[model samples]
Target: MARVRVLMAKPGLDGHDRGVKVVARALRDAGMEVVYTGLHQTPEEIVEAAIQEDVDIVGLSILSGAHMTLIPRVNELLKENGASDIVVIGGGTIPEEDVLALKEGGWAKEIFTPGTPLENIVEWINSHVKSKDN
Candidate 1:
């Protein structure tokens, strides 16, 4: 079986990236091919990377409290670019109420707040995401 390919991005002007880096490492360690887009990326850039990389999932990390705006933009751009099938998940300093909205609004497939176990993240992808070839 092929490994799942993930594009991890930090969108907007969020300068705090320690947590994202950690998640990237954890995902990599879990045997998924991880492509991290680094910090301060626009939703367009992120979607472009995800398409170019032929990734199965897009994992966005935002700490700028702009999840409501950024996450939806990324999802919209993905659909506009015809890559809406690429799963978009997020992790950040988002509030609980917004988490529900993001998911309910279809902005994010899943939103992981702080304190979410790395295993849970890996497992979510393992169960939910499949390599495109599969």
Candidate 2:
């Protein structure tokens, strides 16, 4: 199987990085090459890194209740840079309504919340990204 590339980022002022680090490690252990951009990233920086890394997925880790603003900004930046094929997903404290709004705003995938198994994320990427490659 081809290795999937994922750029995981922490956008905004959320300095709490334990979750993002854990997820990044899990993704790497699952055989995907993971590039983690440390805390305090802007939407522009995240999108730029995703494009430069040529990743298959751009996963944002936001816990500051700013998913509404950040997710859409990243999505727009990706579209502007012609990196719309890069799947944009997230994991944060966002509400269900916000998740639906993000999907509607072109996030390609839904945000994973607390208690969501790492296996589920791994499986989702395996299925979705692999299919995209074909």
Candidate 3:
């Protein structure tokens, strides 16, 4: 099997990047190639990076309570660009109530809330992301 390539990005105006950075490190340590697009990335920017990097997954870290707006835009852009097969996962201060809708809406395949273990993130990616070469 090939190594999984993941693009981790922070969309919108959220400057809080500590959580995403930690997860980026964790994913890197787990043997995945991680490209972290730094603060204040728009949905289009994130999608472009995902395509440029040719990543298997696009992980968004949003804490500005704009996951609803940002995630779908990214997802829609991916579909529009014919990259919808790329898995989309997110982490940050998302509310419990919005988790189900986010997943069911096909925007975010998974949503990791605060206090979620890094190992869980690693495992989820390992289980879900099929390498592009496969």
**Per-residue C-alpha lDDT of model 2 across residues 1-134, encoded as one tens digit per residue:** 56889999999997979888888999999989999989899999999899888899988998999888888899989999998889888997878888888878666487898889899888888877852444
lDDT of 3 by residue, 1-134 (tens): 78999999999996999999999999999999999999999999999999999999999999999989999999999999999999999889999878988998888999999999999999999888889987
Instruction: Tell me how candidate 3 scores on lDDT.
Output: 0.93
Q: Give the CA lDDT, 0 to 100, for residue 3 in model 1.
A: 94
Model 1, C-alpha of 128: deviation from truth (Å): 0.4
Q: Give candidate 2's whole-model lDDT.
A: 0.87
Worst 10 residues of 1 by lDDT: 13-22
- TM-score of every prediction relative to native: 0.98, 0.93, 0.98
Q: What is the C-alpha lDDT of each candidate?
A: 0.94, 0.87, 0.93
Candidate 1 or 2, higher TM-score? Answer: 1
lDDT of 1 by residue, 1-134 (tens): 99999999999996999989999999999999999998899998999999999999999998888999999999999999999899999999999999999999999999999999999999999999999987
Clashes per model (N, Cα, C within 3 A): 0, 0, 0
Q: Judge candidate 1 against the unseen true structure and give its global Cα lDDT, from 0 to 1.
A: 0.94
Candidate 1 error regions (>4 Å): none
TM-score of model number 3: 0.98
RMSD in angstroms between candidate 1 and the native structure over all alpha carbons: 0.6
Best by lDDT: 1
